[model samples]
Target chain A: MSGIRVENLVKVWGAFRALDDVSFETGDSEFVALLGPSGCGKSTTLRLIAGLEFATSGRISIAGRDVTGLASSKRNLSMVFQSYALFPHMTVAGNIVFGLSVRGVSKAEQRERLARVVDLLGLSQLLDRRPSELSGGQQQRVALGRALIAETPVCLLDEPLSNLDAQLRSEMRNEIRSLQQRLGIAMVFVTHDQTEAMSMADRIILMRAGKVEQSGLPHEFYERPATTFAARFIGTPPMNVLDLAPGADGLVIEGGAGPAVLPAGSIPLQLGLRPEQVTFASAGQPAVVETTEYFGADTITACRIGRQRLMVRAPGRPGLKAGDAVHLAWETSVQHFFHKESGLRCEIDPAAPAKKTRVAETTPQ
Target chain B: MKASRNALYGGLLLLPAAVLLWTFTYQPIVTTFIDSLYSTPRGRRPAAFIGFDQYETMFADPVFWKAMLNNFIYAFATIPLSMAMALAMALLVNSKLRGQAAVRMAYFTPTILPMVAVANIWLFFYAPDYGLVDRVLQLFGLGGQNFLGQPDTALAALIVITIWKEAGFFMIFYLAALQQISPTLMEAASLEGASFWQTLRRVTIPLLMPTTLFISVNAVIGAFRLVDHIVVMTKGAPDNATTLLLFYIYQVGFGYWDTGYAAALTMVLLVILAVIALVQFGYVDKRIHYR
Candidate 1:
């Protein structure tokens, strides 16, 4: 009630629903990231909260006040656009003070806010320069300055750092995080980059196809994903999903050489293993290394098991080469199982152990 | 030798254009300047050199001063009015409204129609009593007045027609510019708590400054160059009230057959256009951001 709350928000464009009954709430001073790929309704959710777009049927309130039917200007929120959207004709100071000036704030008050924001953003030397004259990083800072100077209850950012280069993006990400903390304002950051979300947001709302797949802390998303979609989306290398079918002995790896078993009543389970959970053991399911990518500290090796591919992350290169024979092994504790049809994560009983049958000796064809 | 050959090839490629430019454009401009220094020849008599004589006569002619004054007023009034109307029309059509294509085509119809034809259509509208305008005024129990008959109203009526003919053409350019602006900017402005007028004043208008400057230059040139409506509608009637510089030049050169005096008047028109171009490009252009 003290921060931003959106309930049952729906945005329909003709027949396609951009957002479907989306509900979320942010605490005061909470930084929430609407994380999703393109067309996942992340930006649309931000826009609806900013009041730039109307919800088909829902309620949006900020600071205990209902603003579902309010115009964007009256909503009393600020937004930083991906394009930085600084007025091309206005100087850095002009862009930052534009909102105050237009709201008919007293001249003395405008100058006071302007000086505070300029100093906060370190924009003293660049105040007189127009947007065109400023560099990309400077423009991004000015965009931040514009939003921060308003000192509104909530601030919405639509992929604000997406236009910057990698170095500047990380730098601004930290700046924005610290600024949000210093001001203790509720902020909703929308981004497709998991790293940006994980590094910046206190809460991550993972959306897929206009619906929330999962919403929790960043580590909660990585450790205990609610769904298979969440598991694959939250990690960098992504979780590997291998299909399994019932066999005479146990649940056999569908396209690979392995004799594995699922719990009773498991409906054609798919085994989910993260790359770091996989290792090159002395004996396990047989796979042939197909490719190896080195990234200074660690190496990710792509191994072919019959027709299915599995990625194994090994620290310090592991001296692996393509065409080498390897056996993949992972602890049952780290393994995640999901029903192949519904794609929902299946709960495995802690007392039961994953049964492994005969190790089939199959050579790469 | 290779460089020389390349230079020769470039010159050869430019030869036809240079020849045509000299033959048609440069030659006429130089000839006009030379001819302006002399008095036109009479029947069975040779022309005589009278340096500045045509200029002296032009300065003394009250009709010439009237034409100059009328041209300035026409430019000053029509340029800003048409541009503002164009921006409004562009904004209206740019939005996703019903029948938007039809509305855009309707606004642009006057630009494609010949000026003579448009003037003829306006002629009926301004025709003293039974005209469309008078009929509309009659609805208010007001009698129809001669719109194009009196000297005061004639120029004003012509000015209105020019604005109608020109605003739509300028709208096309403004529409193109307005479409190029990212829609996210509007969303960002609204989220920043900017009102509609404030966004237009701060974001839309400043971004459109380059386009406005481009349209203004064209409007200035067209102001001095266009006189087809004057020739068709008033023909400088009601005591030369609506006679523009170009129309007076046509009268002096073709009707009175005073080529020397007409050339002098043409030089004045050319100088005015040149000054406008210089002022726009040298001064105003620096303030406009290309993007």
Candidate 2:
């Protein structure tokens, strides 16, 4: 029954603002991943929510009770650090029971809770071992076990999987998601990796600088990016952004080997096409293949049109050479439009006039 | 051949230091052992070997035994108190308080002051009649007790001054240990629903163990070697209340002109210090497993 609400949260470090008047709400048992690049206030927001850090100016409420001035212990929230800061002196069982021991639970109850968490995390044999004896993945599980034994309403994880190897990260990511669902706890996870956010989060809050760019279902962010920064950040090989100038006929991309007339329904400003969306066509902008990366299932061809480089992900393997010429275009529905100066998306509504002002920004532009 | 040449160069560079150590360090210890077994006087003939009689006589002397017992009490008393005070001071200095640097400087000031200078200053403070301590006690209606003059309180008074003078030195080690702890653990503990005291006891204190053991061993050795303050201030007076082992050795060899008994006492002091060193190293070795 623990829902979290942040109202007008602001974090200012002397002159730099890390979280600038950000506000959001998480329903009961919701798993929200605060996703952004470095310095985007995602980690800071999680820390503030966990009471590891205090907001400069904001109101925080948990389960409808205001917890703005409460300390971490009083707030009854658990956090797993990125470094897996397990108590080095304590064994796994001892680490798991630390919170219960501090709360003055009976020895029997502490043992019961310890057994439950240890069994859940598969730490039976490792109970007698100290944190240093465990591998990185095992240490992470122990850290999560310590937090879980507390049975707090809300759990905050700050890049818990970032320290693991790639295969272990993916495995542990699924494990953590399943664990959170089983426990039915509201969780705020922070990560810079978009793949992690997309795979695990019920809702993803994408941020930039010190503000929320957009937060919604992962598919919504990718298919309809609201800002140019979000558009460039969300994908691998990323979205291709090319300059467009309004011509007498239609919107023609300015710099390519040969000019390209944008497909109908495309806005007359800057345009973006995801690498997967763009395809080599017989009749489109002329491009010289600069490099080709073979990734088994798909081949990403890096094409240079004058000064502009467009990445195209072909369906199958590509045998294109560095000096080969190719034509590139995308379907009208898949292209994104943004204002040239401000980088705000240009809405393509047929009901409105040819060009409109006063636009709003969304994430994944 | 290159390795041998490098070794030769290294050995050549170390020759002067090796010669100095042999002359200054080994020579004195060997000479002391030899001299302790002989009989000689200022205006007498050359020394003659007079084996275990000196050691036996010194054992029978009650004054020497009382001094040895007093030294043990002094060492145990001052070491624990000094180590505790050092730990407390380290915690205070490690905290995020305003004027922390100034507080650190103040705590460390006593360590830099020479022991003789400190004794001179404290002797005035514990003076029976016109001392600052008596004057302050009198303001609260608790005056007229001779601190250094009375046998009951003289050793206790000496212990207090020793702890006050030396706790800051041990605090530097504890402070280094405290600073080495990753602040992330403390933050993680907080998020795990641990109170400040719980974090201190569970996280900080356990991590400070190696430093504590190191400081404790050194404090015990310091208790034995640094009996000069008692020598300067009390002089083993008021029925030998504050008489320590090293002071007893000094009184026997220099003041009483009894070198054999002094050497026997010096041997006892050596054994005690050796015990402290062994325990320190053993505990540190065990601590490395956790570290």
The residue-by-residue lDDT of candidate 1 on A181-284, one tens digit each, is 99888889999999899899999999998998888898888888888888888776888888877755567667766645454454778878899988887777
Two-chain complex of model 1, DockQ on C-alpha atoms against the true structure: 0.61
Q: Write the per-residue lDDT of candidate 2 for residues A86-115, one digit (tens) a residue.
A: 889888888888888878899999989888
What local distance difference test score does each model get? 0.87, 0.83
Task: Give i-RMS (Å) per prediction.
Answer: 1.7, 1.3
Q: After superposition, how far is residue B172 of candidate 1 from its true place, in Å?
A: 1.6
Off by over 4 Å in 2: A257-268, A349-365, B1-27, B40-42, B283-289
Q: What is the C-alpha RMSD of each candidate to the true structure, in Å?
A: 3.0, 4.4
Which CAPRI level is candidate 1?
medium
lDDT (tens digit, per residue) of candidate 2 on B33-68: 777787644555666788866777878988878888
Q: After superposition, how far is residue A7 of candidate 2 from its true place, in Å?
A: 1.5
Off by over 4 Å in 1: A247-249, A259-266, A353-365, B1-20, B136-144
